[model samples]
Target: MSDFMTRVLRRETHSPRSGWSVVAAILVALAAIYALLESVLAALGQPAWLVHPLDALTWIADLPGPYPQILLGAAGFLMALVGLIFLGNGLLPGRRPRHVIDNPRVAIVVDDEVIASALAKCARVAAGVTREQVMVVVSARLVQVNVRPTSGIRLSEQKIQAAVESQLADMELDPRPAVTVKLASSGVIGV
Candidate 1:
C-alpha cells in the first residue's frame, strides 16, 4: 500500500505552461481591465471619455456605417470574456483531497545544537516562550522544548508559531513546532 501510494504521488519533472497559455493570459488581462474601467464609469455616472476619444478617432476612418462601435464593443467584450475564463480556470476548486496530519505535536527531549538554537531563537522573540518558560528535556534521541507563555496576548500564538515554523523550515528540519497557546491574563491581542 505504501509503495502504491508513493507511485501515485510521484510527479514528472516538466514546465507547466505552454507559449499559447501565456499569450491567452495576456489577452485576458487586457479584457478584464477594460471591463473594470467600463463598470467603474457606469457606477460613477460618468461617460467613458477614454473609450469615446478612441471611438471618435476610429469613426474618421470612413468604414462601413456603425462598424466602429460594433468592432470596438466586440473587441472589448471578447477580451473580458477571455479574462473571465482564465480567472475561472485558475480559481476553480480542486478535486483532490488534502492530506491531514493527525499528530502535529512536536516533543523535543534532547538538547541538540540545531534544536537548541531553534528553540532559543523561538523563545527570544516569542512573547509566550520566555527564557524561564521554555523547558528543555531529553530522552534517548528525542528532544522536547516545552514553551509556556507569561503574557496573555493572542497575537503571540500566531507570531510565535509562524516564527518557529519558518526558522525550522530554513534549517531544513523535517518536523516543526506545533505551538500550543496558554493565556496568563485576559486582554485583546494585537496582530
Candidate 2:
C-alpha cells in the first residue's frame, strides 16, 4: 500500500493506547512524592506525614502466622490483576466505532453515529413517519432500523428495508454491514 493509504488507515481505525500508561505514571509520581515527604519529615525529627517507613516494615515483619500469609496472598492477587489489565490494554488494538468509505484516491472514515443518523433518515422517509418514530443503530457489522408506524396507518417493512439497503449501497461502506428492519408492534399517534 502507498504511504498515504497506510497513514489514513492507521489514523482512522485505531486510537492511542497511552491513556493507561499516563495514569500509571501519575500514580507512581504521587507515591514517590509522598515517600520523599515522609523521609524529609523523619530526618527532621518531625512527625511522619503518613506511616513511617521503618514502622511499616517492622509491622509487616512482626505480623503473626496465618494473618501475614493471607495478607501477602491477597496483595499478590491484587497486583497480578492490575498487571494483567495493563498488559491487555497495551497489547490489544484500540479500535474506534467507525466505518471506512473506500475511494481509489483517498480514504474516508465515517463515525457510526453519522451512518446511523443517515439510515434513520432514510427509514423515516420510507415509512412516512416522523423522526421520533424511527430509531437506527449502526455498528461494525450490522445496521438495525426500528420503526413505529403512525397509528391507524399501515406500513410496509419491505419498502423500508429496501430504502435503507439502497442508502447503504450509495454510501459504499467498506466491509458492508448487514441490514435489519423491524416495525414495532404498537404505533404512536401520527404527528
Candidate 3:
C-alpha cells in the first residue's frame, strides 16, 4: 500500500482519543473559570462564590504547617495520583482490540467481537454443532474456540482448530492471531 493509504488504515483501525482526556480538559476549564470569577468578585469587594482567591491561596500556603502532616500528605498524594492517571490516559496510545483485513481497494477494520462471531459460525459448520455448542473468543493475538460436542458424538479438536485457522487465513488479518480449540470433557444431549 502507498504511504497515505497505510496511514489512513492505521488511524482507522486504532481507537480515538481517550474520553478521560476530554473529561479532564473540561474539568480544568471549569476550575479556571470558577477561579477567574472568584478573583473578579474579590477585586470588586463582593461576596465570593466558593472561597475568596486570596483565602484559598493562604490555605495552600499554610500547607502542612498547622494541619496534620498525615492528612496533608494524603491529600497531596491523592491529587498527584489523579494527575498521573489523567496524564497517562493522554499519553498512552489507545489501540482498539480490532483486526485489520488488507484489501486492495478498501481498508477493512473488523471488531474482535465480529471476528469471534465469524469464527464461531465457521466452527459450528465444521463440527456439525448448534450455535450454542461452539463459542469463539478473539483477542489481539489469539483466537480460542471452545466446543461442547453432542452426547455420543466424538469431536476432533484438530479439525475444529484447523477449520478456525483456515477461516482466519482467508480473512488475511493483519498480525494474524494463533488459533486454539478446546473440547469439553462432557457432551450435552443432542436435541
Could you say which candidate leads in TM-score? 3
Across 79-113, the per-residue lDDT of candidate 2 in tens digits comes to 99999998988998777889888777777889999
Better-scoring candidate (TM-score), 2 or 3: 3
Off by over 4 Å in 2: 1-3, 39-47, 60-88
Across 102-176, the per-residue lDDT of candidate 1 in tens digits comes to 223432122245466555567557654446555543222233545555444444556655665565555443223
lDDT of each: 0.50, 0.89, 0.89
Whole-structure CA lDDT of model 1: 0.50
Positional deviation of residue 42's Cα in model 2 after best superposition, in angstroms: 5.0
Give the TM-scores of the predictions, in the order they appear: 0.28, 0.75, 0.84
Better of 1 and 3 by lDDT: 3
lDDT of 1 at 135: 54
Runs of candidate 1 with Cα error greater than 4 angstroms are 1-113, 136-145, 151-155, 174-191
